[model samples]
Target: MENANDGKYVHINGNDIYYESYLHQQSAKETIILMHGFLSSSFSFRRLIPFLQKEYNVISIDLPPFGKSGKSRRYRYSFENLANTVIQLVESLHLTKITLLGHSMGGQIALNTANIRPDLVQGVILLCSSGYMKKSKPLLILASCLPQFHRFVKRRLERSGLENNLRFVVYNQSIIDKEMEEGYLAPFLKDDIFFALTKLIRDREGDLSKDILNELRVPCLLIWGEQDQVVPLEIGKQLHKDLKKSKLIVLKETGHLIPEERPEEVFHYIKEFITDKG
Candidate 1:
């Protein structure tokens, strides 16, 4: 689960996008673009990638304004922009017909990417995906406009403590080790993350509507943690029903961090999915 390999960054939409590539021995078979959740980075896929990279070319990204990626005030943090950025990053690498595998907020971005450019994306895998959430309310949007808003966000994060956030995401606390906490906390050590997060507050759009999801032509594989508190399993059920071509799998006793909690099972399912779909 450690970042054993040093990742590189690519300039996209006037911002530097950070990504790590794990190539299989013979990568002509399949390719996967892995995206992490809100407040997460490519590190989230550390365990999952080891198994995936054994068979598929895996690329994990740190969505802008998080991790090592550039935190520019001018960079729009909207989901649409982020999706486009992902597509541009893939095209920049000259990779096409790849699958988009995402968790939580990244799941929304993956869906948006497929919806935007299905020619580049052949499949989508969503784990504990975010769905049906509305845009930021007027009050929160107004609050983000304030000069001291970034400070407020910084203080709130400090007050909550990273341990609490980690506990909230996982049903089992045994996995909350020193390395895991440090991996997640590393990106926020700099003060600039606060302002970028504040901008994200006003920049991010709502999750896709059911109508839009229903029209997606790409085949989808949705995995949900039964005990997830962040995004309930019911959302996954609804997502399964919404997408015309999708299969949902529920992992009991698991929580929001599906990759962290069930890498083996996830990898197994992914293997079966690609083989069956192919």
Candidate 2:
């Protein structure tokens, strides 16, 4: 299961978190923390790490129950708990000035962290982030109301035959190749991981909107894919309006997984943003 790009693991609070650190030898002035989306690992940033590592220290962690990280039966896998875990990781690494970049569910975690600990975070970059959207489709509302039905859907998704279905739901089917499909499906193949995903989905349904976006004192960047189906493009536009100091960049012909589909473009935007701030 170990790849050449595999990072070191650290046992924190009874959980083994898979984390990769770059530029360890150099004296880093600041650190950039990359958070992946739901059902995704630090592997999401595989394409951008080399370019970023050369300049600033780059760190990415696989959250509990995802990737090679430990799965805890004790933890409820809530957003609050995840955010707390991330804060602990930051403290452990002795990172004072950190730029938090999160995609999808990770973005929500970043927003929660900023709201709770503004002093620790310097800036934030959200990619197709959740929150700020209230419209739930009838099917979703029905699934929420019926616990059994929700469980059934979850189980069905984890089946090997449903890999294509899952990929279609997450990304544009036309762009999903064999390798990409395998990468997305590899995580759900494990029973514990699937259970963890269900827990995450339940917790994600709760409200995570923040008023801090309107009063954001720190620099922020919002990147979204124009063809994004999960979070929708309109939500990104709304976030731009909400965050006063935010810059929104929408990549045309891209889908929900912007980092994977448009790595070079996304990397350039982030690199320039961080450099300009300094």
Candidate 3:
């Protein structure tokens, strides 16, 4: 499934993980691993990958049950397991020092990975992440309780026309082109994929508030969309307050999908951060 413009898969843990490797031709000394949010794939980094590849070996992967990756009904989709799979990918690729960049659910996975294997990661970048949000919508809370119900709802939403239903989740409707909508819909169309997503949501619905932010010692960057309705701007502010070494950049006229909505701005900050660290 290798395309002329995108990268191919490398097998890991009986799953064919889809990833795009950029700057492989160049002699780069650093590696930047990009992880996309829930229901999203490596395609989320389409805008920033080319720019970052100029200096670092940039690699982006589609999380399990998302994108071209295989989904299994038997496996549990917890953040810890996702983090382990990511660490395996890093080790399998022989990446020594990595700058991990994660968006939304991917941000949670990145933090988990960094907490477990701090030595392997050099820095962390989180975009509109979800660890700090304690309260969600009542429907989301109910869906978390009933996994099957959640899958059914997601299916109904997608079949009923995802573009319209997803307007609330995305900041700008124009950012979600036909291809992007199709990409978002692809995973939920599969039964196994739906099950995996349900499991992930259910597993992370508890109160994760306390003091998890204090565990992060790596240099961190928190980017948020001021108009974000999914994970609210307040959550990002709370994250910045809790994480001492982290810096927050709130972009105006942006929503949950910061990387997609404002790719150039997001990339500029990320590039500057990488350069300063290097």
Candidate 4:
């Protein structure tokens, strides 16, 4: 285990998962865990953390191979493993019951974890979550075998350019500021990420099936962006149907980055839902 201002690292399953803990009032009973999407880190939750920490203990995690976490070539990057890693982290912290708030790929992981161990999770909040996706194509899997192919991954990602990527992430163009751009680009400055991503492509499995999703009894609150290009509102609709205990809210003029696009509104809904459930 290691500690730094960026966050604290806990060794789990042979990899160090970097995370920042904002333990608000010790009297606060609920703990909310924040999980970021693919290629994103704890940085994405910066806007919402302050609001949550004021009322609940908030913990933001940088999933393995992203942010300051260890980028291990041997660690399996499958969603199940990632979810298990998250579970291990919760166990390590001796958390009794927790709520998971995950965006995009992180939401997928959140569902996977809840389904695996319902007793540990009190509820889940999925922000424009990715759902019902097929596995990586055979061609991509074969390409992952090429020696030093990580360079190609790096090149393709860099070619897209940070500004262009941010434009796609949020519907409000004016919100794309220097800080947001720099936050997303910071981890890429590390050369090891490309190789980890290469391994990730080969290890990733398809999203959970409807039958599996149907088994989850944990309550959920899903917030979606009406104009989300990455994961559409329909996907959230499908999730609401599959996860029987879930309710979804869609925000207008919002895109893939729900938290970044509507932090205050999201917080309001979250407070209402959590408080009502309690």
**Which candidate has the highest lDDT of all?**
1
After TM-score superposition, what is the CA distance of residue 55 in candidate 3 from its true location, in Å?
2.4
- Give the lDDT ranking, best first: 1, 4, 3, 2
What is the lDDT of every predicted structure here? 0.92, 0.75, 0.77, 0.90
lDDT by residue for model 1 (1-278), tens: 22235489888998999988876656446889999999999888888988887788878899988888999999999999999999999999899899999999999999999999989888999999999999999899999999999999999999999999999999888999999999999999998999999999999899999999999989999999999999999999999999999999999999999899999999999988999889
The sequence of per-residue lDDT tens digits that candidate 4 reaches over residues 1-278 is 11222368889988988889887545588989999999999989888886787788788999978998989999999999999999999999999789999999999999999988899999999999999998899999999999979999999998998899889989998988889988999999988999999999999999999999998999999999999999989899999999989999999999999788898999999898899788
lDDT of 3 by residue, 160-258 (tens): 677765676667777777887776776666576766666566555432344667867888889999998878889888888877678999998888887
User: 187 in model 3: Cα distance from truth in Å?
Assistant: 2.9
Task: Kindly provide the TM-score of model 3 when superposed on the true structure, using C-alpha atoms.
Answer: 0.86
Instruction: Give the lowest summed-lDDT range of ten residues in model 3.
Output: 201-210
Residue 115 shift from truth in candidate 4, angstroms: 1.0
- Which lDDT tens digits does candidate 2 get at residues 1-278? 11234478887766778888775456767688888877788877777777667667888888787888887655656767788888988899888879999998788788778877889988899999986644445566456545455456456665636455545444546656677667766776657765555445554445355565676677889999888888898988887888778899989888888777778888899888888888
Looking at model 3, residue 159 earns an lDDT score of 74
Q: TM-score-based ranking, best first?
A: 1, 4, 3, 2
Best by TM-score: 1
Candidate achieving higher TM-score, 1 or 2: 1
Any idea what lDDT model 2 has?
Answer: 0.75
Selected candidate, larger TM-score, 2 vs 3? 3
Candidate 2: list runs displaced more than 4 Å. 1-6, 133-154, 159-175, 201-207
Residue 33's lDDT within candidate 1 is 94
